[model samples]
Target: MNWNQFGYICRVKSSKTLSTEQKLQLCSESHLQIYKDNGSHSELAHNIAWQIAEDEETSQKQTACYKNIPDLINEFKFEHKGWLIYLTAVFIIYCFTSQLYQSFVVPQFVEMYSSFSPSLSATFDYYLTYWYVPIMLLALLLIIIVMAIIKLKNASSLTTTTPFSGMYNILLPRRLRNEYDALIAIIEFPYAYKKGFKATTAETIHFEKCESLGLELNDEFTVLLKQKLMSFNAMAKSYINKLVILYGIVIVVSVYLFVKMAYQPIFMMGEVL
Candidate 1:
């Protein structure tokens, strides 16, 4: 009851022409190869049951995979346990940092912002003189972070989301990317995002989701689904890249600022004579 089997199940139910042997092979061989291509084979191994079942009925009827919407929405769905753990860790970190910022940084920054009036002020108020540069950089950093989180979420899914409740899902893009990479061969869809890094097509994946949600697939629905899947990887990449940039800027700024404030040479030669 893993992605390979679930994909196989969906494939068996959705596909009208592919024979049993074809279905069997698709479940057994194709997805693993797909996993190795774009995602870590390790992730696939964590999510899939590699051994062939002795009977067809058992293979077809296995209930271990994610079945319905409720579980899918509320439960952990990644093929890799490590990613789930990692995402949980990040979410915790985000929560603490957000709290600390709200408690301490926000009030101070707010005070600084209030000093922006010309009639009441000099060129540099106490807040403005010390905080102006840090504030500007932090503002840029926060804007980039918010935008990246939003973009990453969009790339992985097209469903209604609850941000606070969905903390563990920050890593959804990575999982989706892996799925696309490994399953693209069986899915036969071009990776629409990164060069030489392919994933399953939305054309291939959207219907599976529709079925999971028990939604009827009509022309309108198909078009909507296609749009969601088409640029998902691109969105995910955009988000991940932005996050990387944010982290990089944060590290550089923190180090530079700390050094400037903590160490100052009052005299160039320090009374060398």
Candidate 2:
């Protein structure tokens, strides 16, 4: 079953009504169990189940977070659906137009121009030959830059295994920084803590800071985390919108330039004829 169904079951089967072994058995027999062997459950579900069986307060916190997972995921998908559709449409259009021009339009135009003007035909041939060179080079450059950035990030001393640490280290706005911090603190760190894993230096520091500030890791904290998550999703959608617009502009401008180049020769040939 999906997380929503599992969460609903958990909610219905209150801890006060069920013993710790019952909760553990529920987790093991559920779809969350990845292996038939003893104690081999999906990490998140296992951690949540263990937390619930261990402490009443932590159980309440985890139960609240567990029930909200579906809403959180749905909200993210809803926020970015429009931009995703735009991106898919643009990609399809670009691919279809490029294929159609190369397969049908190019040959016809080359034949027509060749019969009328050899120079124009040569110009068309040259453009057709090299049109993709710059695009390929730019793509290569972007790949190289991304690889370099990843390498640098890996080599940096500040690097941690925190979920959003890479993004957190980037030059994000103060608001996004807070959201990333909250994500790590409320979600990831707690899971790691419950799973008996050693906290990384960054996680330890964040937890200390939260404690120093007298932050309670309660239902209110979960609500704050949910808000931060939604805010981050909104920011992600904004970035995606900007990227889609920028990419659409690039595609339009490239097509325009190609059309102008292709037609300019035809116009010159017409004038000569």
Candidate 3:
């Protein structure tokens, strides 16, 4: 992945072994060398970094740092997929069902308003009668929105400092705002058109699985992994933060529409009087 290359590049950046200017020049020269032409040094550096981040020599180690985390990754995947599907289903059901209620009830209420000056008491009657279906539906939708926000929150921790041990654990980017944006983060490639639902991941396999398939983990595996976690976390945090804002907007808009849909005629009656 392109992010993998970034991890390698960051370590070198941290090491201070090569001055910043030197690394920049090297990537620039290397870019020309590889493409047999000229291109962005930053892009070449990114590619070089990922090439250095692999587990090519991982089998030589007794216990790889990422060895025990395979189950964790799988469990995370299942949970993520489940919540994404559930959220989508909730929105779809609300769309169809809300349309039904709007079609069946609002026109009659509007017609009633035009025929006579309906009493506030009569309007309250409509609330009691018409509000039940959509109130219940809005509540259900609200719950799903809240749950999705929680899922995004749980999946967002990419870096942390264990103050006691001073150990840093690295994590890959998961649970992005959309699959295409997530893929861009993983591959470091651009897209002309990005499309997807609001929750998704790039296909990242655990290191143990890679080892089993005959790949090797390097000596700096944990550090490199941690670096990627830090790198991906920066992007994931920004994206998911926007998602939370989006969820909040949806909740507000849905509730506003529900209230207006359920009671616009009553308000119109008051205006008529």
Candidate 4:
């Protein structure tokens, strides 16, 4: 059947602690063999034991935690959809601005220069005729490259998500803040949404599982996990803040560059060359 139905079956079947009636309530009929409702406790327990054993085996195999590369790529692509539109608009604006400058403004100014002096008229004509297109295209290409680098680096680099990487995921845009929130939702999807509860439950499950094995946790374990979550949140905020500042800097620098380039003089030859 559908993925939703499959997921329900998996979740119910995976829970050894669940009862037969509980399984019936939660799962559909087709998956009953995987999670038979009226089975003996010993049989149910055996299935659960086997399931746990299998889960542990798969967990060990799968738990060699590499980068969540696929999820990240998908998330990045989804997030950049709006950014793609924005980039398109920016490109259009740049093209329109460049065209308007060349067509209406530059020629008029050239004519005005020619009226002022025959010597300068040839220089202004050369300014428009030779260099304008290449320079504008180069600038636009550089901007696109720089923006691409920033986005790709942000998506791939290790930060708070890394184990013992010591890096933080701080400084982000509000949209990135939303992204982190979305990531947090994914992290907590197995449980209901409650911030403190999610944290406590995660900690409790971890501790209880280990404690059930009669293993003594180092005194620092709780402290460490708590610190990690706190650091993750802080770093996320910092990342957003940094992004905002970076965007501000980009805008400011871009405006300054545009104005500087627009007003700067263009000349072909020196005194005698």
Best by lDDT: 2
Tell me the lDDT of model 1 at 114.
Answer: 47
- Point out the worst 10-residue segment of candidate 2 by lDDT: 152-161
Give the per-residue lDDT digits (tens) of candidate 3, residues 1-273: 122233333433344356656555654544435443222123433443433322223211322333322222222221244545555666667667667756776566656655764333344354445545554555554554455444433333211111112111112233333332332333321111022212233223333345447654433344444444444445544644455456546656665765675577667658978
All models: lDDT? 0.41, 0.52, 0.41, 0.41
- What's each prediction's TM-score? 0.30, 0.56, 0.34, 0.38
Per-residue lDDT tens digits of candidate 4, residues 1-273? Answer: 222233335455445577756655765566544534332222222222222223432322111111122222223331334544554566567556667867887676666556643335554444456535444554555464346435434432222222121122332244444444433333332222222434344544664465458554333243433343344445544553454455445445545654444444333323334
Of the candidates numbered 2 and 3, which has the greater TM-score value?
2
What lDDT does candidate 4 reach at residue 44?
Answer: 21
**Model 3 stretches with alpha carbons more than 4 Å out:** 1-79, 117-219, 230-241, 244-248, 261-265, 268-273
Q: How accurate is candidate 2 locally (lDDT)?
A: 0.52
lDDT tens digits, residue span 1-273, model 1: 333334434445334466678866765655645534332122222332333243554433322221221122223222223433443465456546645654686465455534645322222243334544454555555555555456344323322222223543454455555544433232222112122333345554654565457554434333443444444445455555656566557646754653443222212225543
* Per-residue lDDT of model 2, residues 173-207, tens digit only: 45544554555455555445546655454534555
User: Model 4's lDDT to the true fold?
Assistant: 0.41
Better of 1 and 3 by TM-score: 3
State the RMSD for candidate 2. 8.0
